[model samples]
Target: MPRLPPAPSKHPSVLGVDIGGTGMKGGIVRLGHGPKSGTLRGDRFRLDTPQPALPATMARTLAQIVSELDHREKAPDADSRVGVCFPSIVQRGVCRSANNIDPSWIGVSLQDTFEDALQRPVTVVNDADAAGLAEARYGAGAGVPGLVMVITLGTGIGGAMINDGVLVPNFEVGSLELDGVMAESRASAKAREREGLDWPEYALRLQRFFSHLERIFSPDLFIVGGGISKRPHDYLPLLQLETPIVPAMLQNNAGIVGAALAAHADPADGLLR
Candidate 1:
């Protein structure tokens, strides 16, 4: 008989980190019991991220958060795992580019940095992918089958593709050239700021953008997420498209919950670092 590879290590609990442009949000998630369909609040915290934040600073902050979570009897100390939502194009185990951090972060192994600081396992995934997974599992895409595409229209338009409940990361549709300009530059929250438009106008542009996306991906389900998702009914009605569209059920909690779910799903991988 052929020999099998050694079994991978596993952890009992996870520290879910959602790294954003303005703040770093996280929580200690035990294997069971958390927000179901975006109820929110299950041991979470948010802290402002420093400008040009060094990888070392990120690691230190992560360590502090995880250490506190570990101190609680409810979560594992030595065996706790960490999952991060990084705003960047992640390739293999390195960050290709960071949207919310210093350019020096390019080519850095964020997983390695966090692991070295906390002496635990760690996994770093694109922020959009994390949020998409959450939506697919417990939010808008729940029970829906086949292709599901989620677009987060915040500072930048972030995207994640889920087919059969799996995440296809690093799909920067936002950067695609539309009419000789970056789509995100004209369609994202940045555009709202640049154009001095409100949600209604922004939603109208979103409708036009989604129309293009529908033509390309032809997703069976499309979800709009991000902070703006909180009032999706208000703007979602304005955005017209061919496919079925809905607001993400998890809203703000989607990222953290999804990060935890990502770590928990890959049980054999131990910590992401």
Candidate 2:
């Protein structure tokens, strides 16, 4: 891997916004030493996602959140870029789906919307992809060699593929069919909750899903994320596979931290500093 450029010495900070179905949260991520070495400068602020959540309204809300967080910083860093984690498939700077938020997000240029709203350079990425980036850089997959896959088991399974520290964005492995059913339909966190399956049963479902993935990608490491990561021992111990699987470290903060990381790191460069 090539040596990464050092972070800005004078004012190394960026705003990270996580847009979800229910609420939007943002904070200033202080780049301590490198892109992965980021921490919230202040408390993160959140606002309920607007009703209808139209593109225009959401942009205004994001602007407000940026303003709120920017003011909290000791000194306004003009070079601070903005990164947003949107709960949709972002392709070529455009959002391709609107599963949780308003359907208007489809075909919207989210990167442009956020840039126009904040009057600054912006990087927009999928929420799950952002979370996976965080994990690969600073969480479970950190320093791990070979292919690493971050699988978020929430309402749906969201996957992110990373080789070393480089991200392979938008790898939706969850949509794959297993036993004639979408993998997520049977193994997602929502499926466990809806079915009232105990940890052992849920682990079995995860084992099946992981086994399917192992057959294809043969990833070296698997980092399981999402809200369920809090209770890793409950389910992780039950799984038995050749590939090592572990829970995410940053947990809920991964998306925000990774957004900030992505904002600072150039996309042309595969690895984050």
Instruction: Residues 81-178, candidate 1: write the lDDT tens digits.
Output: 67788888877659897665688889998778878987877777788888887777667886688888988878787898878755677778787766
Off by over 4 Å in 2: 1-11, 32-36, 75-79, 267-273
Q: Please state the error at residue 76 of candidate 2 in Å.
A: 4.5
Candidate 1 Cα misplacement greater than 4 A, ranges:
1-13, 30-41, 267-273
- TM-scores, all candidates, are 0.86, 0.88
- State model 2's lDDT: 0.80
| Reference-based lDDT, each prediction | 0.73, 0.80
Candidate 2 worst ten-residue window by lDDT: 1-10
Best by lDDT: 2
What's the lDDT for candidate 1?
Answer: 0.73
